[model samples]
Target chain A: MSGQLLVFVICGAFAVLGALGLLFFHKAVHAALSLALVMINLAAIYAALDAALLAMAQVIVYTGAILMLFLFVIMLVGIDRRESHRELIPGQGVVAILAGIGTLGLLVFAILGSFPAQAVGLEAANGGNVESLAALIFGSYVFAFEFISALMIIAPIGAMVLAQQARLTAKKTQRERAAARIEAYAQKGVHPGTLPNSGVTALQDSIAVPGLLPAGRISTSSVSQAMVDRDAVVNVHAVSLLTAQRFAELSGEVPPAIIKPEPVDLVDTKDERELLK
Target chain B: MNPEMVALLAAVLFVLGAVGVLIRRNALVIFMCVELMLNSANLLLVSFAYAHGSLDGQVAAFFVMVVAAAEVVVGLSIIVSVYRSRRTTSVDAPDLLKL
Candidate 1:
């Protein structure tokens, strides 16, 4: 077989397989991957068909950009999304497959009936594939190319407008937020300023660790109430030890032994205390 | 391969894409099938360009690719917007107009 024919056969088989995979794959991600396979093989076939520049464009544009866009959308939409098996119409799958095969048969019949016995190859017309295509694109189809440029601009703007979520409420200004906080503070004993910053110490710098108050007690407001409810608050004993050690290092004296706080296990301890009662 | 055989292959791919569009429920999958159909058309255009010994068909195919890129951007964005409000990628989920 001629080398071109060999290229066509192999790529054609794989392209068809990939297309079928696109059809039958249950996962959207898998279907996207299969479509990418089909696109790559089609680019190979385009190369065999003497559209060398087109072949490269096919790989770069379709496989590189478009399929990646598809995969991105798939991920955004949720990769684990299942393709609904429940047909919208009864027996739609069977009917669709049969119709597709029938359409393929009709196309084959038409091609066989009308196509010439031999194709006139592009060897003479293409002095160089890139130059000739450039001549055609910039010369004859230049106006169409300009229109395409317009389309390229418009499409992204349309996409942006379509995908953008309209803001439902006006954003509050800093002054407005401060006023609201003051109003709440006047009506009820609520803290007006921002909550104390989460703890940062040598032993533990986690949000679950409450910062120490100026009075040397752990500030409850520093760690969120949610953390306390979930029993995720870090023990302050270790942090106290680290602080003493650092102080001793600075003063060149032995670190004082600090008493450990009773470990707080609010939910379990409450249940245990009830059981003991 | 002969241009005719290449034409046959393109036809097969186009039909496969059509069936995929029909059978697939996910909007993203359907969008992919439409891309497959467009790619198959590009293949046919390239093959005919080879057969006729002219670069016009290839140029046409190049135009198709550009238009397809623009179309995909708009179409995918619409799909994403629909998904955002609806929280499902199923094509049938957005059937508020259906009685």
Candidate 2:
């Protein structure tokens, strides 16, 4: 095969793969990334096809700006969003696949029947791809170009208008929140003040490490309940081991090289246990 | 490569995009499939430009890109707004139009 045909085959294969990835990936972010791959490969094919300017624009606009926008919005909407597999209409998948294959066959046949066998390459017409494109844009399609600017202006304005959230109620002040908290504390005996800060131990200083209370008990309110529920919270024994070792070193005691955290029975206050419950 | 090969590739991508639109549930993914279809069209335009040895097809492709960019911005914003109100990106969630 010729070099141009080779380029087309490779890029076209990758583009098809990427498009398939976009369809099959469960996560929105992954699908977005796959779409980006397809775009970049398509740009490569564009360059191979002698549309150098369009190739650059494809890389810059589609892969760079548009895909990034898609990613940004994906994150905004929810990056971990898994597409629900429950089809609204029964047998939609089979129907869609059949339709797609039929369309593809029809399109392929149409192209094979009508398309020119020999490509009259853009060597003479595109003396300079940039220059010729610029002339067409500035000379003939200038009015459409000007209208596109109007479209560009209107699009952003419309986006801004759509994105702005309308407030349905008055904003609450800090005092209001505090008052509500105090009322809850008085009526239901809930904690009124801010929760304890996350742990800052000698070797482990992560939010998953619960704060050490004054009585050497782990503060129930320090770590997030979500972390606790997930069993992601750092063990109190593990965090305290380093602190104990450091204290031993400070007091001129030779600490063990590998101090395995032994199970230490923590004194759980009734109120704190109730708070946890 | 001949215009037919590029046209064939574009057709495949276009069909893939159509299937994606039909089957995918996420509104954003559907929007992306729409973009894929538009890109396929742009590729065809560029290929035809090469066949005719004229710059007009490339110019048309460039216009498609501009319109596409604009469409993405507005489409994404609409998706964002819808997500905010509905708290889900599934295309089937907003079924108020369904009879």
Candidate 3:
């Protein structure tokens, strides 16, 4: 076998394996990494085919930029491993297998019917891979090329607009947030210690407070604070129930008073208070 | 390498991508499978260009790559936005259009 053939077989095997890995990996991060592997191997195949410019572009655009973007989104969204495994659409797996086989059979039949068996290797165009691509893009397909550029620009802007939180949920300014925090403290008859010169509050306080300040005997904020302080071992099941109740309250739904565990002593230690200071 | 063998490889890869797209529930994974299918098509185009002794195939492949990049930007943004609202990446979760 020629060197090119050997490389093709190896890269082709890698591509198939990577694609399979991408499909089956349980974690989104792992799947993203597998896709990157497949893309890099595909770039290698492009190079083997003497499409140098395409190979470089594939590496830079697909593997480098696009795959990285995928990883960023996966990380930003927080990887949730407990995804529902139930098929949302009934019989999707069986249909997919059948469709795959049908597509393969159709492609093979078409190739056999019309593809010429003997053909020459690609000729070097007017200049080379990059130059010829530029010529064709600029000369013959310039309008389409310009349209794609416009599309590229519009896509990011649209994505930003789509991904942005609704105007109602727009983040409050530091002063507004501080004021809200102070108001929450006042309602609870607790003195919010000296306000920080800067806007952001302590991490513990922020985590302890729910977005909606609820006045109640069993507060989710107190539970979370106890969890943080390691003062109480709140039952995991109970914590989840409390969280659901809190969510309901935040959504303006009537929250049911579930099992209220004995309130753990708040860690209002002098040392801890000083630490907050 | 025999052009026929290369073409066969591309066809198989394309099939795998199609199967993946059909089977995977994760929107991001499905998008990646679409990219795989696009890559396979690019491979076939380059192979045919080589066989025909023409540059047009490679040029076409280049255009496909560019379009794929643009598609990724738009598609991923939409996916991210959907995830932001629903907190789930499962393609089947969003059934706004389900009759």
Q: Which stretches of candidate 2 lie over 4 Å from their true place?
A: A173-277, B96-99
Q: What TM-score does prediction 1 earn?
A: 0.72
Q: What pairs collide in candidate 3?
A: none
- Cα displacement (Å) at residue A202, model 1: 29
Best by TM-score: 2
Q: Judge the docking of candidate 1 as incorrect, acceptable, medium or high.
A: medium
C-alpha lDDT values of all predictions: 0.85, 0.88, 0.73
User: Of 1 and 2, which scores higher on TM-score?
Assistant: 2
Tell me the tens digit of each residue's lDDT in model 1 across A1-277.
9999999999999999999999899888899899989999999988888888999999999999999999899878777766669987999989998998899889998888566678899899888889999999999899999999999999999999998978546889999999999999999978998899977877788888877655445666677755664567776655676687788899899766554444343223453232212
Q: After superposition, how far is residue A247 of candidate 1 from its true place, in Å?
A: 46
Q: Which 10-residue span in candidate 3 chain A carries the lowest summed lDDT?
A: A195-204
Q: List the residue pairs that clash in candidate 1.
A: none
Docking class of 3: medium
What lDDT score is found at residue A127 in candidate 3? 56
TM-score for each prediction? 0.72, 0.77, 0.70
Q: Name the candidate, 1 or 2, with the larger lDDT value.
A: 2
